[model samples]
Target chain A: MPEQLVFAMEVTLNGLMAGVLYALVALGFVLIYKASGIFNYAQGVMALFAAMTLVGIMNGQVPFAHLINAIFGTHVHEFGWSVPGFVAILLTLAVMVLLAWAVQRFVMRHLVGQEPIILFMATIGLAFFLEGVADLMWGSEIKTLDVGLPQGINLWIDETTFQIFDYGFFIDNLDIVATLIAALLVIALVAFSQYTKQGRAMRAVADDHQAALSVGISLNFIWVMVWSVAGFVALVAGIMWGTKSGVQFSLSLIALKALPVLMLGGFTSIPGAIVGGLIIGVGEKLFEFALGPALGGATENWFAYVLALIFLVFRPQGLFGEKIIERV
Target chain B: MLDAAQTTDVQAETLLEVNNIEVIYNHVILVLKGVSLTVPKGGITALLGGNGAGKTTTLKAVSNLLHSERGEVTKGSIRYRGESIHASDPADLVEKGVIQVMEGRHCFEHLTVEENLLTGAYTRKDGNAAIQQDLDLVYNYFPRLKERRRSQAGYTSGGEQQMVAMGRALMSRPETILLDEPSMGLAPQLVEEIFGIVKDLNEKEGVSFLLAEQNTNVALRFAHYGYILESGRVVMDGPAAELRENPDVKEFYLGMSDEGRKSFRDVRSYRRRKRWL
Candidate 1:
């Protein structure tokens, strides 16, 4: 087995892992886009805020510390400041839910019946606001997140030597876990959209806001629920990426990859996001590995956008978008 | 041929009563000025007028679709089943068996025919079984819709889309349905077919209807009672048969003279051809 083939296989697997993360972010974009026509450019910042909030809560930051100190004062520090990872995760989720509710109640509620472009700009405003809030709360420094997931590789075959008729491929356990988690989340989302009353209402709102309101579905409640669910997906993505690298503003930049994924997948498609993410992921990784040497080593930076641009020219409605026929 | 006792009984059950309602749009421009009418519990009721005669506004007021934002019902009240439903939400009105099929079909183009029907039943708490029963009922009334149940509504013809819209409203189990211009864009044959279904629904299922129409002759044929609006006011109101026989209405609207109708038709055809070319 050649070394180059093994390296290519490793890069492909790595790309799949990255693609799963992109899918998670794209899922958030799709959720918000489906419920409200807003593109929610702030989705990346929302994830950043959630991850930052988790870090702040875990480290006994000012607000949480002050609340605890006001109750118990001096003995608060002595009572073991470290919270369980699961508990911190849950608290972070609650905070995300509250933030989502507040965002809908205060920001989006007032902007109802506004133009789509105006709403998009409002989300951009929200993104900057959330980013500032996150920085103020957690400080603009990178933090290591230990979510109790196992680190390092667990190999099936010893020494990465697996030969299948003179072709060799390498596998990593982290890549395997990421794939499994992505698959599970996708399945859960599908079931929730298909079976639940709220899910149907979400789809209804997605189809037409006025009609949904006419049918008695609360637009506000659906918006909050979708944002909260998207927040949950972001938290999961943050944990995966944060554990792999570190929690920082960089995670927000990584989420920008979802835009291209959305372009390829169609803004309203759940399944399309996942598949598009994987394609972008693998394509970028393969490109960077095979062509990075000639391009001076960072082809990953623009690969997704290029693929999305090409897809736009061919399938403007997106891979899974409903065909719109103008009747005028 | 119907009995007098049955006529009295049917008249006694008043389905909708609009009492001196005045609707103003955008805090100015009165659309409906002290408009009032009553629809019996069975058979069709026609609201006839020119484009801005407030006929559509009157229907919107009944459905609560016209509020202060777009238009306000500033005076009087709308009572359904002896209850003042002036402030009722559109969906609540639907739940109470007062569904309005809007002026345009307004079918959810992205959804399949069956899915659009399901949306009509959004407020229904009944389990899937009851919904399925209603779906079957709707399918029986419009067999073409049943064949295209899985097809997206955007692809359906205007006539078929109107059926989907009416079928969707029926899915909510509305006792009294408000249909606004069901024959607006349909061909003459399709118009007759739609009116036939309306008659059938009223007779067979006992579903009450307050239908607003521009075509007086066709509406008078199906409706038991009718109202004529001339410039946002009811100029004439009476039994359908009585109104049909009125020389004044026939001369002005029904086009009793063939020469008058031929000129109108000729102008319409000329405009249509000009637009088409």
Candidate 2:
């Protein structure tokens, strides 16, 4: 292979891995939107909150520590004993589940049968509320998360590529893990949705609320279940992103990247999220590599949005979204 | 109001009773004004009305589906098997052997025909074998649904979608189905076919029906008893055979009269001459 071709292949490979992470975030949005009509604006902050909660649990930091310390002048922070990585992850998941129930009970329950736009506006309000709550619960401090996931370049890949093409391929172990995890997550989600009884009810509810209700499917329960699943996805995305870059307020901004992915993939699709993430990921990276120098570099930042904008005009349903079927 | 003469003929046990119900939407607009009806077990009762006559509202009120649309039964009580169900959840109503096949054939559009039917059995604690037996029963009633079993409900024809909706309600093993507008947007032949199935289900399966229909002609032929709703109130109630012969019904609804095919101009003055008013 030519050296330029090998370099392009590496960039594409990196982009694909990055796309998996984007798909991870997009999965959260898709899950909530699929089960309920609400487009959860709080999805990014959910990832941030889950990651912060995981970190706080692992470090044994007191929740609402700043307020507690300020109010009491007690200066008590950590419990002085860190939880194991697995245990912390489990604890964070439980908290996320609790959060899901609370969201459905307190916010979504009262807003049932409201207009979709109104539900969407509620999510925007929820986003700010959750963000404030997360900040208050886990003080606004950047924290490095180490969940035992492997990171850095794989030497085996480097050596194998060097031997095969006279050039070493750069591949991060973390990205490799993310790709594997994402593949498994997609498979699990597909299986759960395709075969399980609850999964069928969830899809039924997604299709028509009144019909689903008529069939005796509890909408509130399904909403909480979907939110919990989305919360779990957010936790996974949080773990991956928190490991890549320390857990911080900026961690939530990755959801903005997912917006283009969803726009390209369609809001009501799961496979679309994954495929859309990959397309945006590889397209942006390849675009920057091919045209960055000519365009004064940094084309990667705006490439996905431009491509998504073009997709919106032609095929608003995305690649795998269910086409709107209207009859006279 | 149901008189002793009307109630005396239907000696079968009452499956559902909606008493002098008043439905208000958004807490302001009164939609159902003191409507009352009865669904006798093993019988088909039709709630007949034109558009905006509160046919759907009366059915929703029975199935407790009014809450979702911001409509509430502000005054009356709905009872199923002698239990007050007006305030219960729609899901609970299904558990108590009642389900509503919503107007406009609200089949889960994304789901395949078979999957849509399976959703009907969501509340069933019975195993898959029993549910599958009922599934076969539904397919028997709607063999066309079996042929299009794998196809998406959204892509099916209007008549087939209506069948799918009715079949879905059947899968729930409902004792009383609050069917709303089953004949809407379907051909006359298909409408007759659906009514045939409803009659079969009522006779063989022993499922009671409180169906709302705008096709008064077909409804009167199929229903054992009927209620004529006009402007949110039941103006008349009688046996279907009697209702079909009633002069006012023959003129206004059946589009015929003793004078023979009265013109629209003459029927315009019906409100003043209507005996029930």
Candidate 3:
């Protein structure tokens, strides 16, 4: 293979890995949006909070340590015992579930049957509140997360590529692992919503709440389940992103990147989220690689948004979104 | 011919009883003002009214679906099988074999026809075999639904969507269904077809119906009993055969007076002098 061709392939492969991460975030958005018609602006913050909670649990840190110390006029942080990563993950999951329940009970319950914009405004408030709580509980510190996932570049791929093309292709082991996990997650989710009784009810609720309720599906139960599933997806995203780059406030900003992804993929589709993520991921990366030098570099950041904007102008319903079927 | 035995049998079994219920939306807009009706077992009871006559509100009150729309029953009681269901959740009503097919054919547009039918079976704990059997039954009744079972329900014609909604309600194995405006937006032929199926379901499946409709002629033709609601109140109530022959119903609803067919202009003064109101 030619040097430029191989380099482009490498970038494309790397872009696909990055796309998987974006899709993971967007999956959380899609799940919540499809079920509740809320855009869930808090999704990125949910990822940040989950990652922070996981880190806090793993390090045996006392929850609300800053408040505890202030009240007592004494220093107390960790419990001085580290928990195993797996146990910590389970604990974090439990916390996420609790969070989901609280959100549905306190926030969503009252807002039932409200306009979409009102529900959306409530989520915006929820995002800020969650971000503040996460900061206060975890003390606004950047923490490195080690979930025992293999890190750094894969030597096997590098050596094999070197043998074939007399050049090494760079690929991160973490990216490969993230890709596999994402694929599995998508398959599991698809199977669940496609086959399960609750899944049908969820889709029914998404389509028409009155009809779903009329058929005996509890809206509250379905909402809680959806939020819990979304929380689980957020946790997965948090783990991957935190492992790549330490858990911090900036991690929540990834939700901003996911906006363009959802716009391309359609907010109501799961597979659209994945396929849209991949398209944006590769398109942005490839665009930057091809035209970066002429444009004075760093076009990747805005390229996805531009492509998504163009899609909005043309196919507003998105790639896989259910088109609004109006009978006149 | 109105059979005396069937009439007495229907009067004996009151499946759903709404006694002088008042429905208020957003805490102020009084939609149903002291409206009352009943659904007898194995009978098609029609709530006949014009637009905004509180027919749908009355049905929603029985099904406990008014709460979601910020509407509530402020007075009187709705009972299913002699048990008060005024404060119950809509899902609880479904569990008790009472479901409402809402106005405007609220089919899960994105779902396939079969999937929409299956969603109606959400509250059923009788297992998949029973559900499958019911699905087959629904398919038998709504043969067109069976043909387009794999197609997205939104793409289906208005008549088909109405069928999807009714068929979905059937999947729950309900003893009584509150069907709202099943004839809306469909051609007259399709309306006849839907009402025919409703008659079949009532006769063969023994499913009771409390259908709200504006098509008085057809509703009177099919319903065992009928309630004529005019602006949040029941102006008249009688057996279908009696209501069909009533002169006021003939003049106002069927557009035929004793002097022969009367246009709106001719009936305007009589409408103002409505004796029942």
Candidate 4:
């Protein structure tokens, strides 16, 4: 009984950490969707692109080196000099910002006032374009990223929990750092939306675009700002995922993991993303650990999605999503 | 000596002018056919009409929000404070002290009432002191807003939402406010309260108003001048008192007929034949 209790506690902790990562990715979707009414299927690819750009810049890899070599029949992959990690991150941010502005200017600007489904489909196309661009620019190669994020077990937590039970708690310093950063990010976002003038305009835009415009808030400016912010968030999420595994194409698929988090929380609520991420993270982990063997193992794959499905049937608005009151 | 009312009328200062504007939507539909109106400085000019009578479109054209709906003022001009603003963006219009409070009480539902009011001051480069003072001023008029200031706008009652909408407009410190349907979907008491505040703002702050309203009785009571629109044309224009007493206005708009009781079918047929336009 004691061993089972300790195992449950460890699983819960791990699930919560995983959920924070999901929430981080989900946040990009929330920001873009709320501002422009675009589902932004490209959010995951944005993160992957951001990670690839960071890695390529840090390693001094030549942009479109593969394409350049293919066309000219020359082998050239290195820019001949590597940048420091912090400088590479800054450069990646700059690139993401440029991408955001370009996207708003070329795509979203023309797509304004389009139907929700139409905007959503446009983002799916955007996702493919972004992914292809990232691949073409960075080459389809996986790379290890070391930005000095903490690794190994948190001995202090392990030791502290050991006193409570015969077995100690197992957690990593990387997760602990991620958790702290996610909490800080949430605080910053809430404060931004609540206290700042631009933030209030953002909320207004999310509520009603016409109302926001009538109040002297520039809809395009707000959309671009939201996209830029989402880009930054993608960069953060990419960095976290890249540090955990390696920078690769699959990193973009993490966005799929975030969809369920959005379903549980509500796509429009910032805090909803956090809570939903936590619930899904813990729910999946605990389920897999407690019942995976009985259910032929690998239950973590679909547990979160199935739970979201049930929520959809019972409460489609989601836990924190706005109450949808249809009027004639 | 001229009557005090006549003395006041002699100071008719034009603030906003929409001169013979023709608006088209989706490049095919003509929404506003040669629509022309003027809002005088420091006076309430009411645009009264029923559903689909182009009242909202007229306001949107003045605010330059028509483009969002694929609607364009293909002819004529809209000038604010003696400057052509027919081509200006909605934000630029607001910056020029011409703000429109749209119909349907479009408050930022996710934000608190206070935050919605704050959004109104988005264009103002003025210091926080002035913004705060205006916020206090809004609270003073719609004290109910102060009571529910911390509450999310979506959760507020319709009456309170209407108050938030008007109070939000006041925060912009506009030379003129284009109000639409302030009485829509509100209880009679709440409608009176909202109009009472509108009168207070127009009287005390001297802010000009060009409000589009279907509630003819209420709008005429508060407005100094009124324009009755039909089928995208200004069918009638006169002082508020004259229109209120105008037999056609009484029979059709006010739902009262001096020719005694009439059947519903009789009223519908009269609507077809009494065509003031």
Candidate 5:
């Protein structure tokens, strides 16, 4: 087998792993967008905050200790013990929920019915505010997340022999776990939106705010519910990415990649976000593999944007977006 | 003016009273100038007017869609069931059994026919069984909706969408349904069909109706009471049958003379010629 083919296979595998992470972040965006028409640009920062909070809590940070003392008013350090992985995950989810509820009540509720662009800009401000808050509370330092996800590459098939067969493939167990988690989250979100009463109310609010109000669905309640749901999703994405590459400000940049995924998938479609993430992931990897040397290397930086720009020109309604019909 | 004794006799069965309500849009333009009318309970009331005669604005004010910031009832008040609902929210109005089937038949285009109907029961504090029963009732009234239960509303025809909109309002189980131009932009035959359904819904279900329409003949024929609005003011008010016979209303609105028809045709053709240029 040729060295070129091995390089291509490696890049493809790597790209797909990154894409799964992108899809996770995009899922958070879709949840907020569907429940509220506002584009939540603060999603990246939310992920950062959730991850930072998780690390702070796990490491016996003073502010996390102070927050616990203030709320439960019990002086505690590092939860006084080490909990199981699942228990820690559940505890982190509770914190995310409280954070989401606070943001919606204090920030988003007052900004209701404003222009979408204004809301989008407000989220940008929120992102910066949250980043500063996280930095203040936890101190701006990269931390290692130990949620007990398996580490190190476990290559099932030998690359050298597979390369000899001229059809080489390398698969990592961690990458496979990420793919499975991404798939599970997508299924859960779709089911929640379709089968749950609150989910239906969210969709109704997304379609028409006035109509939703007329039907006695409380807009504020739905907003809080969706924000919390999105926050939970961000926590999951943060954990996955943080575990894979360590928790830091760079994880926030990974969340930013969701913007182009949203552009390609259409902000309203959940499945579109997942598929768009996969496409961006695989496409960027292949592009970097095929054209990296020609473009002086590292074409992956702008590949998602280029693909999204091309899609916008041709299929602006996106993969699963409803076609808008103008009536006189 | 009718004597106070006669007005009291008329007001005894009134369900809705709009008393000298002056609505100003943007605190600048007075859209409804001292508009007043009475809609008797358990009967159809026709608010006859041409375009921009403040008919739609009056309906919106009653529904509480008009905010004081954008538009306000500057002078008077609106009473539903003898209680002033001047500053009530639209959702509160629905809860209180007053629902509006808006002018444009604002159906949720993305939802299926059944889903749209389910939305109408949003305010009801009933179990699934009751909602299902009401859903069945709506289907019985508009069988076409039942036939297309799984179809998205965007694919439905204008007439069918109108039925869906009406059915959605009916699902709310309102005591009084305010319909704004149910006949707008429909075929003549479809318009008659819709009007027939409205009459049936009113008589069979005991739902009172206050309809605003430009088509005077159809409205006057079905309504029991009528208020003729000219330039945001009620110019004439009487029983529907009597107003149908009034000479001025007949000449200007309902029963146009042959010469008036000729002038109407001449104006239409002149507009067509201008479009050709």
Candidate 6:
């Protein structure tokens, strides 16, 4: 293969990996959005919080220790004990589930029947609240998360491809792991929603709340269950992203990237989330590699949004969204 | 022909009883006022009315879908199998074998027809064998649904969507179904076809139905018992045969008087002759 061709292929491969991550974040949004019609702006922040909690648990950090010390002028940070990564993950999952329940019970329950835009704005408020709370609980400093996932380039892939040509496709083991995990998550979610009873209920709730209720599906229970699922998806996203760039405040900003993904894929579709993420991911990467230098570099920053905005004006229902047919 | 005020036949084996119910929407505007009806075990009962006459509201009240629209049963009680179900969750109703096919055929537009049927079975704890059997059974009744089982409900015709809704309710193994506007937005032939399937389901499956409809002629033709609703009140209740022959029902609802088609000039007499105030 030619050097430029190989390089482009490498960029495309990496873009696909990045797209998987974006889909992971968007899956959280889709879960909550499809089930409750709530555009959860706090999804990214929730990921940040989950990542921070995982790190804090693994390191045995005290909750709100920084705030306590700053206020009382006393130092009390670590608990002097380290928890196993696996144990910390389970504990963090429990916390996320609890947070989901609380959010649904307190914040969402009262806002039933509100307009979608209002609910969306409420999620923005939730994002700020969650960010502030997460910061207070585990301080805003960056923390490296080691969840035992493989790191660095896979030389085997590079060496084998290089044997056939010049410059073997360089690929990160983390990206491969993230890709495998993302595929598994999407498959599992698809199967769950398609084959399982609760999954069918979730889809039905997403379709029509009143109809689902008429068939004897609990609206409140479905809402809480979806939020919990969203939380779990957020945790998986956090783990992958945290491994790439540490757990920090910016971890939540990935939600911003995923919004365009949701728009391109349609907010209600899981497969669309994956496919849309891949498109944006590859498109942005290829654009940056081939055209970024000529266009002032860093075109990846706005490429996905511009693509989604243009896509929306032409096809508002999105790639897999139900056709928005209106009747008088 | 009897007067509209006449109440006839209260069966001892009634499965659902909506007794003197008054439904208020948004906590203020009253919709169903002192409306009472019953669904006998294994019988088709039609609640007939015109548009905005509270037929759908009455069904929603029975199915507990009222809260979603800010409507509630402010007066009287609804007893299902002799138990007060006013405060029960809608999901629990399905568990108890009561399902409502909503007005306008609220099929999950994004889902395949088969998937929509599966959703009706969500509350069922039966094994896959039975569920699959029921699925095939639904297919037997709604063969068009079987042909388009993989098609998205949104793309199907209105008649198909209505069949999907009914087929979905059947999958739950429901004892009673509250069918709202099964004839809406369909050809008269399709309406007759769907009602024929409903009749078959009732006869073979022993599923009781309380269908709310504005198609007075069709509803009364298929139902064993009929209630004529006007402005949220049940103005008349009688056996189907009696109501079909009632002069007032013919002139006012079925669009026919004793002299064939009643012209607009007889509208004042028809209004005066409506004995129920």
Candidate 6 C-alpha error for residue B195, in Å = 2.3
Task: Give lDDT tens digits, candidate 3, residues B123-205.
Answer: 88889899999999999998999999999999999999999999999999999999999999999999999999998898889
Give the DockQ (C-alpha) for candidate 1: 0.33
List runs of model 5 lying over 4 Å from the truth: A1-10, A60-114, A155-174, B1-14, B17-29, B67-75, B230-235, B255-262, B265-277
The weakest ten consecutive residues by lDDT in model 3 chain A span A319-328
What stretches of model 3 exceed 4 Å from their correct place?
B1-11
lDDT-best of 1 and 6: 6
Docking class for model 6 is medium
Q: After superposition, how far is residue A104 of candidate 1 from its true place, in Å?
A: 3.4
Question: Which scores greater on TM-score, model 1 or model 4?
Answer: 4
Task: Please identify which of the two predictions, 4 or 6, would achieve the higher DockQ against the true structure.
Answer: 4
lDDT of 6 at B83: 99
Task: Give DockQ for candidates 1 onward, in order.
Answer: 0.33, 0.84, 0.85, 0.65, 0.31, 0.58
Q: Name the better of 3 and 6 by lDDT.
A: 3
lDDT of 6 at B92: 88
Relative to the real complex, the DockQ score for model 5 comes to: 0.31
Best by DockQ: 3
Candidates in order, TM-scores: namely 0.87, 0.97, 0.98, 0.94, 0.85, 0.91
For candidate 4, the TM-score of chain A alone relative to the native chain A: 0.96
Task: Give lDDT tens digits, candidate 1, residues B59-94.
Answer: 889988665236788999999989999998877888
Preferred candidate (TM-score higher): 5 or 6: 6
Instruction: For each candidate in the order shown, give its overall lDDT on alpha carbons.
Output: 0.81, 0.91, 0.92, 0.89, 0.80, 0.89
Off by over 4 Å in 2: B1-9, B272-275
Check candidate 6 and list the clashing pairs: A216-B91
Q: Calculate each model's fnat, 2 decimals.
A: 0.26, 0.87, 0.88, 0.82, 0.25, 0.75
At residue B57, what lDDT does model 6 achieve? 91
Residue-by-residue lDDT tens digits, candidate 6, A108-158: 877766678988988999999999999899988999999899999899999
Model 1 chain A lDDT-worst window of ten: A156-165
